[model samples]
Target: MSSSAVGHVISLGCRLNLAESETIRTLIASNDVVVINSCAVTNEAVRQTRKAIRRARRERPAAQLVVTGCAAQMDPAGFTAMPEVDRVVGNAEKLLPASWTSHAPALVQDIMAVRQTAPHLAASFSAHARAFVEVQNGCDHRCTFCAIPFGRGNSRSVPAGAVVDRIAALVDAGHREIVLTGVDLTSYGPDLPGAPTLGLLIERILTRTKVERLRLSSLDGIEIDDRLFALLTQEQRMLPHVHLSLQAGDDLILKRMKRRHSRGQSVALVERLKRARPEIAIGADIIAGFPTEAEAHAANTRALIDDCDIVHAHIFPYSPRAGTPAARMPQLPPATITARAAALRASAARRRAAWLDAQRGTVQRVLVERPGDRGHAGNFAEVRLPPHEVGTIATVKIERAQDGKLIGMPA
Candidate 1:
């Protein structure tokens, strides 16, 4: 091992999760040890995390194999069962030191002794030219279909000054783009002494930091509020793309799911945002088959998305998560969920195609991430002139739309 290695998940289920892992990486990088970042989102994810711990143990034979992330947060006990693991901790604030124990026992204690320690707060870009920063850590809203609230606690905001310093550090590291991510990004700054709002936080970054082209991860309808939207409209650095949670369009289903926001509110957010920025690409997430969602609800969702002019949609079929209130909610046969998911997927495909088509001939400043399927683009889209040498930025003119991606030529 390079030093004292600690492991974390590499690939994650969402962009927010990816950002969180990068935060964890920066924390341990300064300690001068081999930090094993994981890339296992599938069943292989568990295998890889476990394997890395074993390898690290073999190399050091005494280094601490501290595990964290969705997999570890979701299944700490399972991961601790691995003989290589010296310490077992949940998603709590305390950094459980393996020195306290030879092997982790049944982690039954709350460990309330650990105050919320922000891990370094120094953000690092997982890629070449851009970094992902987190301004919030946990979630307060509970959608029936998600287990994030269990892994991550109630909404907790990162201090605004810390965020500003982190942004400056990222900029100093030569990153041109920064995507602010969190469990609830809108909830940022409430826990701080001054309690400056997310608006002020962004204002600080824009006015103070030199980082270019700031983007945001997933957002909720109610969180946008009025002031944030106004800032979004005015800010050139803030990306035009937004992925808001629009789980379903039916009001009754939304109530049952405990989404706490009405479809009208989501629609209004879209309308105001589009009015403010006409070319803005709006994206949404839809649960094709919620526990008690009706056929009409699905239809309503499709209609709502179409009306909102959403450029893209991510369709989920309501996976049953363990230890969540939704797991015990109700029933829908697997085949039906699958069929509805397929239908929604078809709609999303068309939605993306139409959006890209509208952008044809318009120039977009594209940040070319890693390579992808065929000769297609990576992370963000439309990289013209060959499969891109990652870390370079190029202006691309939307030439055509194909297979949910924007195919483009050099502008």
Candidate 2:
């Protein structure tokens, strides 16, 4: 990699990481650097991070390799000890430009001590058609199975003003859609002055900016305040899609996980959402074979696909992180975990296929991601359509559902 070339940024994990990697890409002026923005959500994520470091080293032998993000923050020494890694930067320090060039072998800090969110992290320019805005960072809730809070520190939110301004900038730059990303999205605003809710921030952005389509990332169902609920059900500009961080569905498993919501509550929330906006698509994260999870627990989780009408299901076979409470609990056998995960995925696939088939012959307004290619509908359903201008919304009439996508043409 030449010094004048754009630095290679390997972003692994959630949409938040993609948004943050854009900042890292911008901060580094030389191509002689490779940054691995890692994820530590699972042991698999950490393994992939390490694999990426080795791969980058082989691909770009002369380029400096830097590791940052949750994996690096949680275990900086492990990454620094790798021969392929030149330096290791923590989640907090990764945003700082000085950390990139500093001779320090590791820039890990106590993330818990940090309180404020950097406003510059508000928008991402990496994608041509859609832009992501980071409105919140970190998490306050410590689910027994999760290690994100430790890697991300306490929850903090970007000011509504900054978010609105950044969104407006993206709108002006021709991005048709703006997605609000965060570690704990629904946990936004409690740290800010006046404790303005996420709904209020959305209201501000909609009223203050010309942003066409507004979307939200993974949200905790329990934290959906009445105001936010009203907006989600009634707002036309807010995309008709909601992705919840519903880890599991069994009441016993949920209680053991220390989650705030129950299985009944989750079902009720989805019912209410669908009743108000029938077109609203639901997505969720479900863990299969969690610690102490039984066959009944797995069945309850699988049932969520049909009960919640979950088309976009992200299933993770539980992997024990180093310090999480779940790691100490009795774990299911590896074979059992794998089988449960496959079963959950199969259930989701069947449900998703039915949902897609239901969309046949319907009309959808798609945000054209690429001209003459594909984009996504308001409900976040992927749609393949005839040629249309990139970054423009086009009305498409569904012809059929194929390969898990809606094949359409200009309506």
Candidate 3:
């Protein structure tokens, strides 16, 4: 329950949403208000958003409740119907200062009609050690199970100059790491003049800015361009951890989900990445028990975790959204979906444990985010060490792995 002169902002969903909430915090000016930056990635996400809104109302009874983000953008009337909500702002409208006025009611516009991304500049992030710069926004692809495209409009990118300048500013502010985030990160720059690639953007940032560590958010494996692949192999500042948007591992399921890459293609891409950089760590977002998923299909996805040497996996049990194509497909039983999700998680836990064990005795560069013993290593693995200066990157000699984190001392 952090407070400002205006209000408290509660963020949900991806890092992109969290970045937006930071901007929202700077816009409004009423202490008696509470704004919920929501998520609509899954049905469960919507439920959680609603739960947060209600809880906020109970805690701050007099605070005016404002609902915004993908969930609100997708279904404005639904949130406006809530008795606790006083206003509903869309994804596009939430950034505007006018929408924060007490007079504003529901400011949702046609998201599909939006073509250009208006840059939201922030000098710093809420976290001290790292900051996120939004290089792109919206998604062009229409995955059958995703509602994000409708929540966010067609693909638009922030100009390269603006991005480089922002990175330089964050670096000057003493941030040790900078993360480039977007709705569809790899699709960056196609809409801009000359249609420069994301690789070109990265090159410009590295050359023009004094950024120490640069990381990218989730990316589609099929979109890894040749130039980007080269940079990954050659660049030391580019972090060696990649979290892929590989929703399912079976070819048939992937086709049904309208994913661009095939099972073989995904595996091949991971192989190439590992070959280029042996120290690289792989992670993925996998949906368990997707529509029409069988035991064999689930098994293929589970097998892919080991095949790709994926150490971190985000396992989602399929939840039908209101308007997605998958929601209209033949649905699996609740029990079946739950059981398969559990199995996938259990398999992922074993793989993660093995990967952690392998890190023992290895020296790692950890960027400390907390005062005591918490931070993330270069591979994005959570690590615990002796007290170190916050916002400083320290070298640690890994000695043990426990409770999903690596334990180490200063090297």
Candidate 4:
């Protein structure tokens, strides 16, 4: 196995996991160990985690493999049983430097007992232009299909002052954009003093920090507070793009999944956002075939793509996670799940293509994430442009749309 001063981090799962991985990388200095930040969002995710562990073992035969994150936290014994895994660390222990050097084979802790989020700051992100700061951790909601709460524990938040200070520091370090990430992002401050909301936190960041562009990770539509709604309309630094956590579009499926929002409420929220900001881009996460989902429910979910004008959609064919309530319900056939997911993805493709086409000849402010190859516009559309500095925010006049990306030249 090859060795370097810095350990390698293989991150899986959501943006929150990515942010945590950055902190883990900063904490660990060993060269002979590879950290696997695993996810257990679905059965497929666990399979992928196992595959990554095996592949890493094959490539680096002599390296010590440390498994951590949601998957390892949920089932430490399962990961410890794997021959490739030298040790299993829980989510709470993974960020600490001491845990990396400990001899314990399993360092899992009671995540539910964890009350405060540690303020782990990353000086820089590897191969990325923007910085992600974790504002909150864990979830308070118990959506039946989700096992994340068990792995992550109850909701906890970093203080608003710490978040502002971190963003200011990242900006000073030449990071132009900052993304605030969390397990349940909108559920940010209920546990903190004065119970300040997510909106208040954003307002503080924008007011106190010199961050040029601010983006939010996925948010639940039902939790869009009045302050946040107002900020969406008024704050230009807050990018004009939102990815909503709308798992299913049918009312019955939503009810079955223990989601807070109804089908009509989801549609209404999108309509409201679009009306307030005409240029905003809306994206969503929609499950294809939840257990007991019929053709009628699937059709409603399909129609929701058009109803909500969701240009960027994350369509997942439902895979039951062990111990989730939905897993015990009558399962849908594999064929039905595949077909429904395909249909939803196809619809989303058309919407994305049309959205890209509509950008032709329009001037956009794009944050050049990769010099010469790609960057994302304020509305979150990936744009291809001529070579520019990695962090340069350029004004580009889009020339054409192809392959779901917009080709643009400096304006």
Candidate 1, residues 160-196, lDDT tens digits: the string is: 7777888898788777788787877777766677877
Ranked by lDDT from best down, the candidates are: 4, 2, 3, 1
**lDDT scores of the candidates, listed in order:** 0.66, 0.90, 0.89, 0.90
| Lowest-sum lDDT 10-residue window in model 3 | 1-10
Relative to the true structure, candidate 3 has a C-alpha RMSD (angstroms) of: 1.5
- Per-candidate RMSD, Å: 4.8, 1.6, 1.5, 1.3
Worst 10 residues of 4 by lDDT: 1-10
Ranking of models by TM-score: 4, 3, 2, 1
Error of 4 at 287 (Å): 0.6
Candidate 3 Cα outliers beyond 4 Å, as residue runs: 2-6
**Residues 1-411, model 2: lDDT tens digits:** 444444888999999998888888888865579999999999999999999999888888888889999999999999999999999999999988898779799999999998989665634474557888889999988899999998999999999998888888888878889999999998888788899989999999999999888999999999998999999999999999999989898999999999999999999999999999999999999999899998988899999888888999999989998788999999999999999999999999999999999999899999888554899999999999888878889998999999999999888
lDDT of model 3 at residue 20?
82
| Model 2 residue 145 distance off true place after TM-score fit, in angstroms | 0.6
| Count of clashing pairs, candidate 2 | 0
Q: Report the C-alpha displacement of residue 402, candidate 4, in angstroms.
A: 0.8
TM-score of 3: 0.97
